[model samples]
Target chain A: MTLFFVVTLNGLTLAALYFLAASGFSLIFGLMRTVNMAHGALLLFGGYVGWSVVDATGLWALGVMAGGLAAALAGALVQIGVLGRMQGDELRQTLASIAISIILADLMLWIWGGTTYQVRTPSWLTGGTRIEVLGIGYATVRLYLMVFALSVGVGLWLFIQKTRIGAVIRAGVDDQDMLRALGYPINRIFVLVFAMGGMLAGMAGVIAGSALSIAPGTDLQFLLSSLVVVIVGGMGSVGGAALGALLIGLAEQYGLAYAPTYAAVVTFVIMVFVLAVRPQGLLGRAEA
Target chain B: MGTEALLRLSNINLHYGSSHVLHDVSLELSDRPLGILGRNGVGKTSICNAIFGLEPITSGTIMLGDQDLSKLTPEKRAQAGLGYVPQGRRIFRSLTVEEHLRILERKGGNWTTERVYQTFPRLKERRRNLGDRLSGGEQQMLAISRALLLNPQVLVLDEPTEGLAPAIVTDVVELINQVAQEGTSVLLVEQNLHAALAAVQDVAIIVGGEVVERVTAEALENDPKMQKQHLGLEAAGA
Candidate 1:
């Protein structure tokens, strides 16, 4: 029972990380229909930047903010410089993003080298805390990460549901042409959304580094997980991303605990199952 | 009708790759609502698209009261005081009716959300409903009201009466007339001749992508032979 509880907690923690990564990925896809293959590269770059900021300032929160800002700047540049040029061509945009990912990954490798790095957690979050009711100890950082993810999810939901800017975004998601006809500078909106997505990925990178270790392939791993998560949960839906992340996170942890050899294939299986059962995804609206 | 032109399309030409769509289409919209009547695929919608910069015109100048809109993008054209209620109503499926009204509301604009709601009480009643959830008549009213919130100098409506019940059509005609009377220039594009004639003060008949005739509603109403020659109508019917 204790083992099950610990694994469940681990699953929840991992799910939080996945949600942070996939929510942005799903949002960008929802509004622009751009696949943004470079999302993983952005995450990895953010992790490196966070590590450097933490190394310089010795402030974990500052590092997280700096990392997010760096990623956001990069995301906006990517949209303005590359993606915006091929606005309506999805294939070209996807290809350009893939190329960008390759270049960014190589650039990060050149600068940071092949060394693995971890963002040192603040002293308060360094150790485990006991849950008095269950009499179980869990890592404080992981618990905080779960809470942080929840806060972000709630904040995003409120922003999208209640704010005027959120309404415009929702309207753009529904009909880009109509939104344009209504006198919205859609290109600027696209850049803003991309920057926002990058900011989330960057913060997630910092969080992931603090909770776990980040290496060269960390980007590809998170990217794959995000793809699977969005695919299983539904594309372009925040709620869908959360559900998908939870399912994949639990499945992965349980598989690793119970069947180490086949653990890697578990997430893919869930994605395949979802695709077969519901091609539009669990919460994704069907194309008109 | 006011003699001073509020919107003008001078020597406009549009091409879809190799094939020409609108050829030397010149129009001057004064204070009165002008209707462009034509059969399907006769370049009526193309004219709207050209004005909005949805499709780049081969050559021409579109001026909204001396502001050259030919070079502007669709959004820019919209911001420059042209409100478009596109064909099919194109309501954002994810947005609620209230959101639609709120998204386009400009500060100190002539049309406010309160005014729109007052105008179409049904929209206020369905304020919480997603755009796609509304009935066809309700959607049309929301679309019109959404554009009205922009407080545009000119409102372009494409097929406002299409796919509507006769009773709803009557309501839409009344709404168009009311909108024009409120001081906004209207460019109405429609296939329904009676609805167009009833709503607009003047009518332009487009045949083979060219304006074959431009006459007052009264003149077109009295001349059934002209209607049959240009619009393929057996006769003007009630």
Candidate 2:
């Protein structure tokens, strides 16, 4: 019973991480129709920057803020420098972003070296106390991650539904040409959406690196997990991503607890099954 | 010029790369319903776009109430008293009818949510419906409502009654007339010559982007040869 609680808690933590990463990926793809391969690299880059800052200054929130701001800056630059010019070609965007990912990864290697390094957790989350859930004692930090993730989901839902710019974004995703005809600056909306997505991914990376420890090739791992979440959730869908992350996170935890060997394999199978059955995903709206 | 003419297009030409789409298209308008009629692909829509600066004229100028629109962006032109209801009822699918009205609202105007609802009461009923979910006629009403909220002096509607039910087309014509009655100049572009004749007083026929014939409906009714040569439609106003 205790083991069950532990696995479910682990699953929730994973879901929280997946939610942070996938929401931004889904949003960017939803409106811009651009698959940003550099998303993974940007995330790792954010983690390293945060870790380095915290290493130097010994300040936790400042590190997170600096890391997030830097990643957003990189995202803005990429949109202006590369994706802005490569409009109308999907293959070109994918290839260019992949090249950027490779370049950023190498750049990180030169700056921080190839050795795996652990991000120091803030003193607030340094120790865990007992918590009772379903008649089982569990670690407290993991519980906090679960709560934080749930809050992020709710906050994002409210943000997208309530704000004025959010209304424009929703309209833009439905039909960009129509938005342009209605006198909204569609390109500017795209920039704002992309920047927000990048920032969220950066924040997610920071939390995940602090919690689970970050390393070389961590970008690829984050990318793989996010991709799976997106596939399960459906592309261009935030609600779909959130639900998918939770399901996959729990599934992964149970798989890890029982099978151990089929940890990734179980989630992969579920994703494939969900995709083959409902091409648009469980909670996804139709693309058209 | 203030009270005499609301829209003045002079010697406007448009080209898409090497292909010329509009050639020396010129027209003058007052606060009256003006009809621009031509067969398919005669550059009637292109003329509307040029007048609203959606397409930059390679040559010539468009003056809307003393504001030059030759190089202005589409949104800028919209702000400069040029309201265009583009073809295909380009409504934002995600936005509800209310939200559509909210985005196009301008300050200091007779055009308001109340006025729009007064014009088309059906829209007030479907205020919560998304633009896409509406029927063809409802979409038309929403599109026109959005433009009206801009308080434009000149309203350019491209095929306002296309693919609509006969009854709805009547409603659309009545709405256009209402706007004209409110002292807004209407530029009606249509392939339905019969419907166009009922809606406006003046007609300009463009053949290959050049205004081959510009005349009043009474004069057009008298000239059968002009109709046969340019539009190939029988003059029925007589």
Candidate 3:
């Protein structure tokens, strides 16, 4: 029972990180249909940058902001330089993004020296608190991560539902040309969304890096996990990303506990199962 | 009628990968609604598309008021007081009727969301319904309402009544006439001659992508032979 509670807590915390990384991937892919193969690189890049900042300044929040901003800038450059010119050619976009990921990975190696680095958790989140109800203790940072993920989810949902720009985003997701015709500058919207996605990826990287080791090629794993999350959650949906993260996180935890060797493959199995049953995903609108 | 046309297209030429579609097509819209009449393949919709900056013209100029619109983007053209209801309605399938209006709502316009709801009471009833869930007529209504809420200096509609039933057609035509009467200059492109005649003050007939005839709507209404010559519409009880 204690083992179950501990695993559940760990799974939920991991789910939070997955939600952060996958939400941006899903948003960018769902809105523009651009496969950002470089997303994982961005995540690692953010983590490295965040670690550097915290090492220099000893300020964790500043590290998080710096990481997010760095990734946002990188995302904007990628969109304008590579993805924007592809003109709906998926093959070209995919190839371009993969090239970007490789280049970014090499840059990370050159800068960070191919060594795994962990960002120090803030003083407030360094310890664990015992929960009397569950008869277990969980790291305070893990609780913070879960709360942060929930806040982001709720905040994103509110923005997409209540704000004017959110309306334009939703409208553009349906018919981009019509949104343009309505006098809302869609290119600007696209840039904003891409940047936001990058920021989220970066933010996720910083938070996850503090909790776990971030190193070379770590992005590929995170990217793969995000792919599963999006596929299972439904593409282009905020709610879908959360659900998908939860499912993948729980499945991974269970798999790791029972059959440690095959834990990585479990996410794929879940993805294949979901795809076989509902191709559009759990919350995706049926393609007409 | 005046020296300055509100919306002017001069010697416009459009091409689709070297296939010339619009050839030296010129049009002037003033206070009165101008109905563009043409059969399919005659580039009637192309004219509207060009005016809205949807398709780039190979050569020519489009003037909206004092601004030269040929170089501007579609959104810029819209900001310059141009409203367009493109062919196929092009409604955002996921947005609600209220969201459709709310997304494009601008301040200081006589056309507000409440005003649009009052104009199309049925739209008010389906305010929360997604664009895809509405009937064809209701979709058309939402499209027009969205454009109207922009309070454009000129409204361009391309075949808005194409697939609507007869009863809904009357309602749509009535709404078009009402919009025009409320002092918004209208450019209506239609293949239906009767609706065109009823909705506009002037007629510009295009055949094979060139303006073959330009006359008053009343003149086209009175002359059956001219309508037969250009529109190929047979006379009554022929």
Candidate 4:
């Protein structure tokens, strides 16, 4: 029972990471319908940037800012220089993004080499003050992540519902042609949305790296996990994505606790089951 | 802006690939509804698209009052006093009816969300419903309301009464009449001759992608033979 609680707590932390990473994936997909295969690369690439900042400036806050800004800048440049010109052609966008991911992954390998690196949690987040919650003393970072994740989810919901820019974004997501017809410049909106998504991915990368050791093939793992979250949650639904992450996170925890051998396959099983039952995903509209 | 008429589209030519879809089509109009009538194969929707700058023309220009809209993008043209309600009531399925109105806001002495709701009381009742959740008539009403929020001097609506019930069609015709009364130039395309004659002042008939006949609604009612052959109907049968 104690093991179950601990494992569940750990899973929730992992889910939070997945939620942040996958929401960005959802936003970019929602707007342009372009599959950004380079998303996980942006995460891992952001982690390295954060790592470098911590090494130089020795401030965790500075590292976070640096990582986020770098990711946003890179995302904007990639969309404008590579993907923006590929509008109206879905196949070309997919091929171009996949090609860019391959090149970026290779470049990452060349620069960082095939070595595992641990992100040293800043002193502020390193140790947890003991707390007895139903006869279990878990790390404080787990609770912190949960609160932060919930805050982020709520903030995003409000931002999309309450702001003028948010109205335009939602409109764009529903019908890009109609929004453009209303005198909104869709190309500029595309760049801004993509950049915002990258900033989100970067934040997730920084937190995940600090919580767990970063590895050489972290990009592939992040990519696969993000894909699972996206599929389970529903492609264009932000609220669905968060719920999917939590369910998968909790399920993975239970699998790892009781059936350790089945932990790796838990997400895949849930995704397949959901797909079999409802192809449009948990909350998304059916494709016509 | 010239007071003679709100818009004058002169000698417009549109080609898709090597084939020309519109050949020297010119429409001159002011505050009254100009009904664009044609057979199915004729390019009625293409003309609307061309006027809204959704499709590029091979030659000629669309003048809305004083501004020349040929060089501008669709968005710029929309901002420059030209509004469009596309053939299909292209509402956003995920957004609520009110959200759709809010996103298409423009500054001028024009329609606001409240004013639009006042014009379309049905929209106010279905304000919170998602676009897909609304009925066809409601969707069409929202589309028109959204376009009106742009404060356009000239409004071009393509097939406004297509796929609507007779009663809803009457309501739409009434709305168009009310809009014309507000002094906005209206270009209406309709296949229903009875509805067009009831709702419009001037009418143009398109044949082989060009205006074959231009006349007043009274003239079209008078010449039943031309309506029979060109409009694909027999007036006596009706």
lDDT of 4 by residue, B173-232 (tens): 898888888888888887888878878899999988899998999989888898988998
True contacts recovered per prediction = 0.90, 0.37, 0.71, 0.61
Give the better candidate number (3 or 4) by DockQ: 3
Error of 4 at A89 (Å): 1.8
lDDT of 3 at A282: 87
- Residue B78 CA error for candidate 2 (Å)? 3.2
Off by over 4 Å in 1: A132-135, B15-19, B226-232
Which regions of candidate 2 deviate over 4 angstroms?
A1-5, A56-59, A85-93, A129-131, A251-278, B1-32, B38-73, B133-135, B163-167, B181-183, B205-215, B218-238
Worst ten in a row by lDDT for model 2 chain A:
A132-141
Please, what's the RMSD in Å of model 3? 3.2
Question: What TM-score quantifies how close candidate 1 is to the native fold?
Answer: 0.94
Docking class of 2: acceptable
TM-score list, all predictions: 0.94, 0.82, 0.88, 0.88
Worst 10 residues of 4 chain A by lDDT: A125-134
Q: What's the residue-level lDDT of B14 in candidate 1?
A: 96
CAPRI category for model 4: medium
Please tell me which predicted candidate would have the highest TM-score against the true structure: 1
Candidate 3 lDDT score at position A126: 92
Arranged by lDDT, best first: 1, 3, 4, 2
**On a 0 to 1 DockQ scale, where is model 1?**
0.81
Query: Which residue pairs of candidate 2 clash?
Result: none
